[model samples]
Target: MNPAPSHPYRAAALLAMLSQALFCFRLSMPTKLMFDEVHYVPAARHLIALSGPVNIEHPLLAKEIIAGGILLLGDNSLGWRFFSTLAGTATVLGVFAILWLMLGRVRPAVFGALFALFNGTVFIQARIAMLDGYMAAFTVLGIAALLWAMRAESSGTAWSRWVLGSVLLGLAVAAKWIAAPFVAYAAIAFVAVRLNDARREGRSIYAALNARPIGGIHRHWPGMAAIPAILVLGTVSIAAYFATFAPAFFYTVQPMTLAKLLPFQMQMYGQQTQVLPHHPYQSAWWTWPMMVRPIWYLYERVDGAQRGVLLVGNPAVLWGGLVAVAGCLYGWWRTRAPALLAAVGLWLGSYVIWAIIPKSLGFFYYYYLPSIFLCVALAVSLDHFARGTRWDTRFLLLVLALFALFYPVLSAMPLWGPNAFHFWTWFPSWV
Candidate 1:
């Protein structure tokens, strides 16, 4: 086989185009909203009409984007799903960029992104008009920008990347409160890295504060610069998040005002925090990594054909990714490789935190963000253990084959009958 391209952007663009074509293929097949689209699509319509809120439990930016799609495309199935397809495509690119920035290689980046594309969660979420697809896209893009800022060679370039990261993270939270943890992780990680650098250089706290630049930006107290920089960036993120509520201020009914912002936030919090009943497809945080249960978004007769959409991870990627993540953790312990550290950190921030959240119910689809990072870990592990060998090619082919095998259920493609799902479900829990 020919070698992967040396140019990162060239390789990333090709992968992105492929992902977009796959995500957009048969996107409007269901011809109607499925699952949570029942809630979000109507909210998008309400936003388009300047009508009152419909799904106030979440923030507004994602719905606003969907509304913009409807306005541009005349409120059809394609309109409801166009931006989602684009967000899903961006997510594919974001994964490529994150691995590229972290590992500084084209092969791992390409492998990681292809794994993510074949991973069922991103593909399924992209076809539906839901919040998680947009949220996951912004969260990964924010992480990629932050990784770029850390390695930037010039002060101006670093500052621009930092600001861009902050804005993207803020937009992520505006998409859904589930993204809030990632923003917090970004802030804490930035400060910790700067402080660790100071300690590593054997500089006194005082000298570290006064001698060096933060991300190459000159500061009077360079060590202490992270404090003020974080403060400013935090404010910027808050401003970006609140800006998404702009449409709320103009609602034809029950308009929101600046004075009411805090109270509105309280209301949103109350709505999100309410204890809910259990769902049949709900899986515990611990069960997620093992793919113990999968959510069936839709499974019914459509247009006189048996059709379904299952939000399950590609087993070849997800099941194998667990071993890859463990390998990454061991590699990080042995060598402290920055790429391994990043892959592990992304997984922890997105997945482990779910264990501590107070929500009474959780679904398998909530594993979406962490699954993306799992692919990253798999890429890092493969680069370390199997680079320049045929295993890399073989593993990718395996993932692709499994993706194709599961594609029928992952999309709403016609099946032999309701029992056709049994062909793919190897375990009872998956039902």
Candidate 2:
């Protein structure tokens, strides 16, 4: 491990930003929207025109972002993708900062940032107009802020951290519904932290929990100032959301436009719940852990030449990540530390919800956000090993190199046109 410098964190943040920017820049204008781009780009244009959200199924947050980009860049293909590219870049930097604050080391943070930068899945998503990137960015930021709040013992900055965490969480939820489970996971983690404090103080757990803080708040409250700040952040995000839409949304759209839109959302929700007869590329959750079914968001024949790429994750990273997650579970079981526990909770809680939901049209792409947990877990594992032996450091470097080498093949395949299949697809579901 490198020596911890008096102020090494800023340098690390700059590297993360530069790495992500370069990675995103590689394929920014590669091609038009692949799959869902058709729907999202139009929605963004509508949003820019102050068109009612009548045609859109999701919240206005992502559209608003895309709209901003379009307004500035002009309504071109690149314009629609601008926000996702920015969000993807932000996600890389945020993850690096979070890992640094949580792990208190440079290697783990660098491993995560580099891995995310070269990960085929993350790379492809960053270059498109998709809600997933926005969701990932905000969720990671929220998790990082929450971790900061937990680590801060002093009341002075804790409230501010909590407020930032809450606002980010709210935006994350607004971006995608899947963010709900993360909230539950966070709450559970916080309660556990409270319990730990109570146990240490030799007080009744129940009393310790309910006890208030001194002076400003209830006496005995543990970082009690955070709750109000969190509430304020939440309220503000929600208010900001509605405020953006304003009377223009409700007053402008025709009654039928909204009526039709509401039913479409319900239908989409219904579509999500009802299992399709079968999809050629339908992937099970278990397969995701193994990278068994990678969705090809876009594929095209350039000049009748096959040159497009696949969208699967870096196999080494994804496969190793599975092992890493297991290791994370073991670490949490043995140590009971908040960080390890939070990793496991996030991995399980975010994904397990899909098992119960009756969504009919679930696809492999749905695994995108949850895969981040695996990446972080793998990073944790790599960090552990990197601190152990020279060979371990070599192994980690090998993985990063492999990720970078393979990234081009996957990301550039679509640009290759028809002959892009030079790289073999081992699984039928991959096509």
Candidate 3:
């Protein structure tokens, strides 16, 4: 393994800064609403304008952050997306830290940040104003905290880590409903860590368990004692989730009560079931893994000038991630390594939820969270690939190279119109 710098976060800090510059460079390219910005930016303006929130299906944290940016930047395009850019950059940093915590190595963590930056999933989402970007940042924190909490042998530190993870999970959902999977993820991790701790106390517990039957089970039930900690974790998360809604009550003139809130929630639920009028970009969850389709956020040509932003996976990181994820799953099954297990488990937790979201309408960008997890899974797999060769480092360069190749279309930079669209339209659905 390549030795990491003495300061682990330095590479990540550089990555975050670079990503911010990249996302913010042409901040007003289309100079108008781009993709989902139509729904979110107005809601943010509403927060400041004393207008009612227009988009309530999603939670309020992302809009609140965007509103802060708008308040500072004067209700323009840059203002609309400023906070999203920050959240996206933070996603890169958080990915790095999560890898650092998981691998305890500098090089792999750096690989994670670079992979996420060039992957185009997080970067595209980050550049635009959207709920998913905020969710991505908080998801990174939740996963990192869960891993740290799992690793803690000290009870107090473990509880604190769990609490932090719980609160972050709550905040993640506050940014978007899709992030609810993280809460389930933390609970699963907590149970696995405690059970593993119990089993490790002694191998003879197996024999003891075999012979003693109910008593043996009783004797090994220390894992159950951690229930209070689990309860506290749940409480903290719920409290944090409620706290995110306080602004909805305070900022608006209308008083929020259960009478008003209940129907509002049902209205949000109703929106989920409406697939309506056929969106060109929407796809099933299974297709996202294969990069079958991409959503077009914007396409504009005014007075012989052209600019566009396409939300598509950069094949370098996205496809490479699939191979790496397979490596992680296979290696974990073969070696029973805790680190591999953690990566695989986390990837599954974030991804599996999509299969059951109950939303009739979904898009390529919904894969954003899983795609970021893929980068981490790839980072973990690097430990195995890097041990005996330099091939893994070469792969990192190739990922960057691919990102460079796609930079123009990805960033909405001008090019010969047909060539630009043709280069990006590798598949029929992508148009």
Candidate 4:
């Protein structure tokens, strides 16, 4: 890994600004709720009116944020999507930060975040009033913070980073339960790393279990503080997750109380786990990585032209990323490189776990979190192959070209006619 530049934040800021510009462009073109937005935007409106509860199957933070956007911008397209746009940009920054911390290089970080920006899922999710975008943003930010905390040089800084990471992961769950797997991964990874370090330093099992922070300064030997670390992760994350329900207590009708919280949670769990009628776009978990099916958020004629929004990953990024992730897994086995291991762990946490989720109905968009990490794996693979060449730059340019090519279909850009979508739908499954 190369040393990061002293001014990495400047580059990260520029990338985020670019992402913001792209996400905000033609954002209001549809001027109407699309797909799941119809479900969520109304929930946000109800929150604004304190009109009891809506969309109770999910948590409240995401709707609260959407309500805040509506209050600030009024109930319009922009209002529904503005915070999602910001969350999307933050996810870009989070990807950049994760790569920078893992690879300790600016170039690969930029490439990784750019790949995420054009990955199709982020751009589409960011433009809608949905819960996944916020969940994804907080998920990546939490992972980045935890990664940094693992490398911290001081105990105080390490603890602070861990606490922040825990809080962010909690917020991610508060947005959507899909993020629950990531929260579990964070705690497990942290404890595993700490215990491994302790064993490597010749500590006994009892000592490892009893480890506690000594002074404010101890060369950041987190191995000596595994107990406190686990406690902080669990306590802080659970507290933060429950704190998001505070607004529920203020509702005028059937206001939530301490006694109702557990029942409300049970209701959410029951709703989430129940099987639903099959839909045309519902897909099996295994088919997601192959892009076998995509959800058509909008497809209609407007102003004598066909306009559509397709929630699909960029073929180049999603397909090529599979090979890249495989390479990362192989590279990690051989070299035990931290960056490669982190990439694979991210893929497993986000993608593989979905196979066991009790939810009977899944969609292509459910692969959003995995697609983000696929970009990271691709960046790592490209950087390894570059090895003093411009291969990474060339691949990035190719991704950018494809992003441009698909922008019309991804955005609600005017097309030639009803059959215009056929031009971009490469496979029957995609259609």
Q: Residues 1-431, candidate 2: write the lDDT tens digits.
A: 12223454676667657755665564544455667778888887766666465434466577677778888887776677767777887777766766676677766777777666667777777877778888888888888887776666566566677667767877876676677566656655565666676676665555444525333322222355334543555575555444434423443454234345446547546544555688766777766777777776656654243445466777766777777778777877886654565556666776787787666656777887767666677676666545565643564676678766666555553344454454546666666
Looking at model 4, residue 98 earns an lDDT score of 90
Give per-residue CA lDDT, model 1, range 324-411, as digits (tens): 9889899889987767877888887899888887777888888999999899989999998788887778999999999899999988
Per-residue lDDT of model 4, residues 245-314, tens digit only = 9988898888889999988999999989998998999999999999999889999986456799999888
lDDT of candidate 4? 0.85
Model 1 alpha-carbon miss at residue 319, Å: 1.3
lDDT of 3 by residue, 245-296 (tens): 6666754566456567657667777776666767777788888888898877
Cα distance off (Å), candidate 1, residue 242: 0.3
Of candidates 4 and 1, the better by TM-score: 4
The candidate that achieves the highest lDDT relative to the unseen native structure = 4
Q: List ranges where model 2 is wrong by over 4 Å.
A: 1-8, 210-222, 225-251, 255-279, 303-305, 413-417, 422-424
Please give the range of 10 consecutive residues that has the lowest summed lDDT in model 4.
Answer: 213-222
Task: Predict model 3's lDDT versus the native.
Answer: 0.75
Error of 3 at 187 (Å): 0.8
C-alpha lDDT score of every prediction, in listed order: 0.84, 0.65, 0.75, 0.85
Stronger candidate by TM-score (3 vs 4): 4
Worst 10 residues of 3 by lDDT: 215-224
Report lDDT (Cα) of residue 423, candidate 1. Answer: 89
- Deviation from native of the Cα of residue 126 in model 3, angstroms: 1.1
Backbone clashes in model 2:
32
